[model samples]
Target: MSGANEEPDIPDLPAADPLPRSRWRMQLVWLVPIVAILIGGWLAVKAVMERGENITISFKTGEGLEAGKTRLKFKDVDIGVVETVMLAPDHKHVLAKAEVARDVAGLLVDNTRFWVVRPRISGGTVSGLGTLLSGSYVDVDVGNAAKARRDFVGLEEPPVFASDVPGREFILKSAGLGSLDVGSPVYFRRLQVGQIASYQLDPDGKGVTLKVFVNAPYDRFVKTDTRFWHASGFNMAFDSNGVRIETQSIVSVIVGGIAFESPPDSVEEADAAANTQFELYPTRTDAMKQHDRIIDKYVVNFADSVRGLVVGAPVDFRGIEIGRVTAIHTRFDAQRHSFSIPVEIEIYPERFTSRYQDGRTGGRISDDPRGIANYLVDNGFRFQLRNGNLLTGQLYLALDYFPDAARAKINWDKSPPELPAVPRTLQSLQDSVTRLLVKLNSIPFEGLGNDARTTLRTANALLSQLDTEVVPRAHDTLTSAQTMLDSANTALQPDSALQQSTADAMQELTRTAASLRTLADYLSRHPEALVRGKSGDKP
Candidate 1:
């Protein structure tokens, strides 16, 4: 019976030849993981593409830059990472391989500069790490300047600001540059508007070419008549009366700066003509024209004019500093017997014209040169000496204003007189001393020595009379007088025995004479009494 029931089991296996599975089952099994892997790979490829940029940077110092750890940023946003670092063949620089994200590609302009922005201190500002880290680099600025596509170099300092701000370029020539320095502020009426960008030697190497930047609105203030000067450092001074301008602070930041001085009365003219045509010159051009209409009526050689004037002397027109002598050099003039000296001078004609001009007046000297000429004529336009520093004998040219009557006639036919020149300051005193020695050589020292010898002889004779003849005679006379006084004192003594004896002898003589007179009276009748009385008296 159980076999009969179980018979169906064999039949059941054959009956279920049922629905056949699809042939694509094996393919489906293989496809799931493959699809997933493909998707994952595509995503990864996209990520890499988005995160990558190929770039190379050169560095002189690799102190803080690190491979794989360093990042490139655009406006504080991380855009790339340093992939590799290799030393250049010359070992002078390090080449940094970096990969930047594709999103930031457009921001890399032709002028884009890639510099390692590390922490630094400048102009009282602390940047980059903010004292948090030492060696980390921040993406610094590259000027929008066009450059070739190649490896970029990192700068040590980040630029303070964009350059080529619309303005005029002024050129200043100086011997020592005084207190002028780069990054010094430029002030207009004591308000800062610009700064010194950079400096270099002029092409001729005779002067310095300063690249100064003047910002926006203030740039317009610089005009054809604008005057620039150095305003820096301490200039403490005092007069003989003890009144002084003393500097008491050291931390003070009165740094070197530039200033503009314009004619006060021409304010309206300057404003109106501020938009006139102008040009940018890397160096100062001799564009200022002299009053050509006025002929060079008198051409006086510098040496002749200053022959008698010392270095610190005044070249005055009624005691005014029309100009200053910057330097003096000699060149032989074959045509003439003397050497022609070229004297470089600087003049400030502001005060001379400032008082006479008004807002409507154009900046022309010819308009009112009569006053200047008259002043010069009245003052004799002469040179006089002045002491820049008493101790150093440093001299400077000063302008002295004097009445016409006090003026001395200058002889143009004769050579200029040789004048004493002092140092301009203590530092230049050595130069004055050197020149003084040269002039001192011309003094008659031999004659002075002879005069000194004669004076010594007279002094010696007077001393000898006082010491030997006069002193000895006074001593002998005093001794003789002392001796006579001593003898008189002894004779006047009341207790002397000789004095008592003399008194007694006088009494005896008186008694004897009385007795002789009495005997004479008795012998009146006879003369025999006188002789007899004397003989009896002796017995």
Candidate 2:
């Protein structure tokens, strides 16, 4: 075995044909490594090329943002990752660096808006609820601006409407914000058509200015004469029309909203321009009462209490409303040494003239206020304070004819022709009550009580005397009369002498009649002598 092994070693398999150096040198071992390196480099290049642009978004808070964990989303789809979260140079805000996909690079516009999306409840709506489980994310809303941008200032609150949304904006001036919220719906004839975009104090600080957006097509319905009002909560009103309860919807009642309508009779065909300014009324009735005509202001001096009268009280003429009370104040008339209420009122005469006119424009009843006032005075028109709602204690101004009203004249020389005013019925009743109270206070209660007591004692004594003395005398007189009557009855008994005398008189009368008959027969036999004998018998 040793010898065979030695021989095999010696043979060495003919040196295994001396593996060619060229072949060994040309081996693909290095090529394999090179190809792998090349492939790795290509993959790296592709990864770099596919990477997106990095942008920094400054936010007031870092609430839901996390480095490398939170993603930026568009339309609910992830489009980028938050690379880092750090404070800005000023340290006033958090800067979130995000790497957005290259395909969505064009969406980073100047007007692009970003906000953190977390479960939030606002204006009776629950939004971003799905994020509660999936984790909060950064939401990006692309804008329609032409210029592209990288750095963006994030929005603290989500925008009510997207920049690219088709709509028209309008500005409404209101006395107050009421219950309106950013997400409050706007209704057109009870149909939801838009939403309140935003609101803030007016620049002049006189009222609130609301920015509203109406979705496309529906916006075209807006006209110059359109009216808007707050349609939130229950509208409980008691007027001449009686008690009324109105509500837009249960949701609106809770969250609040705005409503608009283009009065068919007032609105023109053309659409209102974008950002048109309009007045926001407090109620639907008020909005409907708005007229596009000149208003005339006047002042009324009343000698009655204006306790129940308030601003915006109805000013009526002959049971029809023609104006509203604007202000009420008390003034001292030094000359007359009396205090009176000076009430300011605004009247829209166009409301009355429009009824007789053919177009939107109408003529005023009278430009010369003094002349009109004189005419009204002659017609027995006078102002009086009356109860509007007895339960609510609300009052209104009433203009009516009072033919027998106290004579009063209008002072045309005054700036606002002072119209005559009759004392309010309530005031008259109060005066009567005061007079009756004075009369009662003046009565001498002590003297009246003494006199009444004395009268009562005298009447009681007189009654006692009549019962005791007069009654006994009357009884004695009646007894005496009864005795006399008994005596007369005894004298008229049936077998008395008067009865026998009456029977004898009857027998004598019968004998006389028989004699007269015998005489009459003799006269019939002898004519003349019988006549004389009959006559003697008759005598």
Q: How close is every model to the real structure, measured as TM-score?
A: 0.51, 0.67
Question: Model 2, 175-266: lDDT tens per residue?
Answer: 99988988898988778888998889978888999999999989998898889999999789899999999887888899999999876567
Kindly give the stretch of ten consecutive residues in candidate 1 with the minimal lDDT sum.
282-291
Q: What is the lDDT of candidate 2?
A: 0.86
Task: Tell me, by TM-score, which candidate is best.
Answer: 2
- Pick the lDDT winner: 2
Clashes of each: 29, 0
Give lDDT: candidate 2, residue 140. Answer: 90
Q: 1-539, model 1: which lDDT tens digit per residue?
A: 78776744344344555798887666657789999999999999988766655878888877667888887876677888888888988999988888877776655555666667766655334567642554465473434555534356765555544533456555555434444556667667667777766566767877665656677788777765655555454444467877654221221145455555454533434431423333221111112222122222222234333343343243444555555464565768777777654444445444355433564232335555445545664564543345556576555555444344344443335333222222223324666787899899989999999999999999999999889998898899899988989877776677776677877999999999999898777777667655665435764
Question: lDDT, candidate 2, residue 464?
Answer: 95
lDDT of 1 at 38: 100
